[model samples]
Target: MSAESPGRRLGLRGRVMLTFALGAALVLLLLAVSVFTISRGYLLDQRERSAQRLASADADFVKRRLAAPNADPRAALMALDPAADTILLLLRHGEWISADGNPPPAPPTPSLLAEVAAGATTLEPVTVGELPYLVVGVPLGDGDAFFEFTPIIELRSTIQVLGTVLAACALAATVGAALLGLWASRRVLHPLRSLAGTAASIAGGNLDSRLPEDNDRDLNTIVTSFNSMVDSLQRRIERERQFVGDVTHELRTPLTTLVTSVEVMHRHAAELPDRPRRALELVGSELDHLRRMLDDLLTLARTDAGLHHDDEEPLRLVDLLDHVLAGQAATPVDADTDGPVLGRKLALVRAFTNLVDNAERHGRGLARVGLHAHGDHVLVEIDDHGPGVEPAERERIFERFATGRTARGSSAGTGLGLALVAETIAAHGGTVHCTDAPGGGARFVVALPLDNTPEDTIE
Candidate 1:
């Protein structure tokens, strides 16, 4: 990247997709957090309720069992410790029996026990061996009593496992949400990708490339706007080029006559008085040069406008060459085609005549003029015997007003000559180039497409 770089980094498609993905991801994260918070809280609340219910139910069942007749109350109480981690205590007539499991340290004291003995039920938090427990006490038959205790450690362990599982689920959901976000982003970006590609093609010089019509109004507007702009730009540029060419061509003939008349007058002006004649002659020569320039400009304009007359009919290159080269000695001018070009006879004559004239005017004589079939085109080569144009100057000379230094002094024609040749060849859907001739000097070759209607050929 240079300072002149086009300044586009992320294309429209990529930017659109990234935005979509980020939005989705954010939504997913919010949803996951909300769900995890509510669900985890609900699960823990339910677990707490279940722990309380189990403690109450076990206490009632043990009480009932101990009150039965001959129940070997101690054994009955021990039976209630299904997990073997349960603690049971029986007190009768001031006597106490402890089970194998250590009793809850915070069991009711004498005063609290007295209250229970007086037919009052008690359920309260207690501590045993530094561990918290839920203690439930109940009155027994005949002044005896029962106590049941449950440690909170088991409940804590269960909650820890549940918490772990919830956390894992939340982690997985977050990851899944990110992937979903990416997928959605891609869907939203597909059309943008198409738009970007079309834009790039147009920027690279294919003005005809356009985005496809889409039903989505948001994207449809963009595509329509871009296509419209391209259409207008192409049309405007073409019109400007045509206007310049036409103006140049329309000025040629008048300028040529003016310059020619001035030159003839100046050649004979020596017979008259010096001062006025010399000045008039200078004006005439300058006008002649100006006229030649105008003619070259007009030729270029016609080529650009594609307005050259081309009514194709059978016409031999041999005869046309003879007429064009009449009164001038030709080195070699041959027609190798099996048939005449299928185009406006006059325009073809002018095109080839211009090339021949240029060679003669600059090289002092025509070297050769011939045509050959190449691929799907016809190659017309005009060879001149003067010192060849340098490779560097070949392309430059085809520009407006360019003149090769060696030939510049000898020829008085406008620099628009080769520029016209290039444009004319292009108008006919063809190309022209310069290269080395077999016998030396320079060879100018024009390749014309041979397909399509003969009359449709470029003038």
Candidate 2:
């Protein structure tokens, strides 16, 4: 047998409901058969007994008529009446005779005839033409015999009505089971739905998200375990962020002093020789790089620790990118579409500047920049005319502390620029990724959700 997915097969609730329906149908069918059998047997028994009694009485009267002077079998049978829908027949001197001079409705079976000929009374069910009848045969002395047939159409009708009622009941029970299954399934799967929702919230950066308490024992076990796991993860992340924040705070003062001291040294650049001047310049560049790296780490730490301010506002994507590029070289931009996006102005600026800076430092300078809207999102593409990002490195490029060669052969980035870009964009409910740009170069694409309406609706 071929394997199939769980979704393709009948679901749990459907199976449960089907089980109940099938079980009820099987049991009801058995009961209906049994009841019909018993009732039919009982009714047929009473009918046969009553028929025998009436036949006996009719036979007694015919016998009396035979005893009379000039008596005739045909006349006696025709004259003697029994019940409605009953046919009488008489056998005298090896000849069969029916009342009304018509064909007999039912003739005794050979077995019944043999039993009756042996001087014993017999009763058997038989079909007369298109209808059903009971044949009662009684033996008379001197090779004489009598038979009676009675129609049982009414009894068959009653049984039919009974069968219909039973079938209807089975159908009703099945429908009720389906309704019950629907309700029970929702109740049974409610906890699972809650778990999924909480997990989604956490994935969206809500570390405090937790499953609520449940009353069911089995469900409660899963809830407790999931909540405990989330709590542990949250605590570990908290400790790590706290350590990063503390370290960055400690380094800030010394780093500022170093930069200030370097600026003072650059003022007297003419007195120094070429070698010394170059050496001083290298120190200042390294210091600047270190300072940028530390700042990126601190921002990440604060964001993770939930200490970042939410001073967000609505801003246009075109304006945001234009301001970032205006500080440096000219770049092509398409500003035909896209609405404002909700974000912090400083954070958005910082992330966009990092992209431009990374391009200038590593990817052989920015080749082209494009901006447009797609559906409910604003897409920003920054292209560098250098060897594009490797397919294998595309996803990893966004990780913190991830270092790799720029489009150029040299690895000159702070290793945290793209990471910070990804983090900041994600904070604004956006995404950033690397791809191969059109015409063979690297591309950094950022997509932020469009905020078309006001910051908050007011009536």
Candidate 3:
């Protein structure tokens, strides 16, 4: 049998119902067999006793009649059974004679007659053609014997009906047990289903989702443990977010002061020595890099804390791409693809800028940026002509601070560009991924849903 057979593939509820049905069927079958056996035995025993008694009375009458002077044994035997269905016979002088003046349906076998003539009583069941009969034989004083055949068709019919009824009752009991098992399974697994739903809600970012209070002690323990674990996880996340937020907030003031001092030094650079002037320029560059990293960190922390909201509005896609690529050296291959998208303009701009910057820093420079409509969404492609990303690192490169082999040895980027781009696109109910570009290098594709209703809003 295959692994996915009907019996193996059955769910828990179905399996439970099957188990109950089989158990009930086995028990009912055994009970029905026992009842039928006992009832049939009792009925057959009673029937045999009645046949024996009737035969004995007839045999005694025959004996008395035979003792009388010039008595007719056949006449006495015939008078004992008025019904034609029953036959009486006499065995004497090695000849068979029927008392009713009719041939018996089945005559006694020689062995039976020999036993009767030897002074031993013989009782046997026999079938004559298709009819059933019980035969009883009694021996007489002169080596003669008397026999009677009783039809038992009615008794056979009764037992047959009883057997059918018992079988039907067993089937009904099995069906009832299966239905009861189904009800019990549903009732028992209801809480577990609810727990699964609650876990799904939490996994989907609804961390506040929790199981309802249950009075059942067995269920309450599981609910309490799950809720406690979620509580601890939520608290730990909040603490980490708060730590990032605090550090970023504290660095802002000092960063502002440092930027102002750097600008002042740059204004007076004409008077400084050449080496010191170059050093000041490097300091200014480092400060700018530090400031951008801080900003990226703050943005991530805010997103984690669910503090930022998208201001969605209808905006033309062609105009958005043009505005973002105005000063960049990148070429727009199909910026004329016209469509109005409902989104936050500022966030979309940031996301597009990050993609273009990522291409410039890691893949030499942006070769082309294109936009086109595809089904219910718009596709944006940013192609770069430099050495493409390795297939193994394609997905990992999108994670925060995840740099590729080429960028790892250099300080060209803070490694948060593609990560932010992924987050921002995801917030707009879109998806982003990288693949090998046509001819060479890497291509980043972003797909944004065209019908951006309020229900798709991201927090």
Candidate 4:
């Protein structure tokens, strides 16, 4: 009925790491693309200039040879040989001729021929045989045109390799950014984690717990503020404990006198009227109730003041319960406590006494008290034949002076008995909760961890 719900949102650490990873990826991708694009354009420009220069020189040489007094144009064209990956073509009288044995994969385009015939030189990039090529066209003095095709396969390969390397580096940088973000998040959240731990210790009654000194200016400010706050809170608690101790001493004398006077009056009841005798009994009962309330309050004050008896040695859960049950009036119980449990003797004795009294007073008398082994813990369960706690008020009843809860209904016996039980058990690192008993009654289960770790005290 009181199960906790888990958070579903991404934590601060996850968000921080994702931010770093995305930011690095975006920036690196942009940089990689820019470098690749710029390098590709510059390299292609240089190749075009080199190809144009080589083709222009060859065209000039063939033109001069044909222009000589005894020149034979066909012989001159045949003598012009180009490299393996290059193809040379000459246009005369509207016919195309190859200067070398190897012909171009595609014939010269009309655009290149028209531009050369217009007395203009042209350098055009085109695709031939599925490979990149630069076509250079030069017009001759004899109304012919010269064309050269050069393959740029090596330049394309270099650009492709560069692109691959940049992509890999960008991917690596993204991974490195994620790792960096994780480290930074842990480093930044360390102080907050410590603060939370210290707060929990203080809430669990360790008044002396404080944040450690920090060298960072901002962190040191928080450390100083937290320690100062705890110091103030501890001082106020100490003052309240002192007031309770003083009040206990001051009230005991008058309370003892009132009880004595009531007892003396009740002894002479047979001689008095019936109404007077009944009134005297009522006065005596109320006085006893008041005295119990005061005692419960004093015990709580002492616990908060850190006045618990020390844990001398490890004690088995069964032996401890046996000692508690043996000293009291006979009660039916089902015992199975077998493991070592760490606890303070006096505090645990009072806690068990309160549990028994609570069941008898609130739950129509104690049905049975039993112990069971629960893996690494021991459970001491008390059952009573009374209506079980309401599901909505189950957790509220554990609070000190809880407002309106059916878990500890009807404020009988000082309203502090269940609270004391919770406190004492919590001090020993245990918990007490209310649930439905097997026979449709109320069950109070005290779960105690079986820890044999040596300690100075229950605190």
**Which one is best on lDDT?**
3
Predicted model with the maximum TM-score: 4
Q: What lDDT tens digits, residue by residue, belong to model 2 across residues 341-448? A: 888888888899898887787777788878888888989998887777888788877887777553235555667888889988998899999989887788999999
| Tens digit of per-residue lDDT, candidate 3, span 356-451 | 888777778788888889888888998887788778778887888875463433466777777888887876778999988996888999998886
Residue-level lDDT for 384 in candidate 4: 82
lDDT of 2 at 425: 91
Model 4 lDDT per residue over 90-208, tens place: 77667676765444458768887788889988989889879888999999856788888988999899999999999999999999999999999999899999999999999988999
User: What is the alpha-carbon RMSD of candidate 4 to the true structure?
Assistant: 3.8
In order, what lDDT does every prediction score? 0.67, 0.82, 0.83, 0.82
How many residue pairs collide in each prediction?
11, 0, 0, 0
lDDT, residue 338, model 3: 63
Candidate 1 lDDT over residue span 281-344, tens digit each: 6787667677667666665665555566664555545566666777566455655663344455
- Candidate number that wins on TM-score, 2 or 4: 4
A best-first ranking of the candidates according to their TM-score comes to 4, 2, 3, 1
Listed in order, each prediction's TM-score against the native is 0.48, 0.86, 0.83, 0.90
Model 2: number of backbone collisions? 0
RMSD (Cα, Å) for all candidates, in order, is 10.9, 3.5, 4.2, 3.8
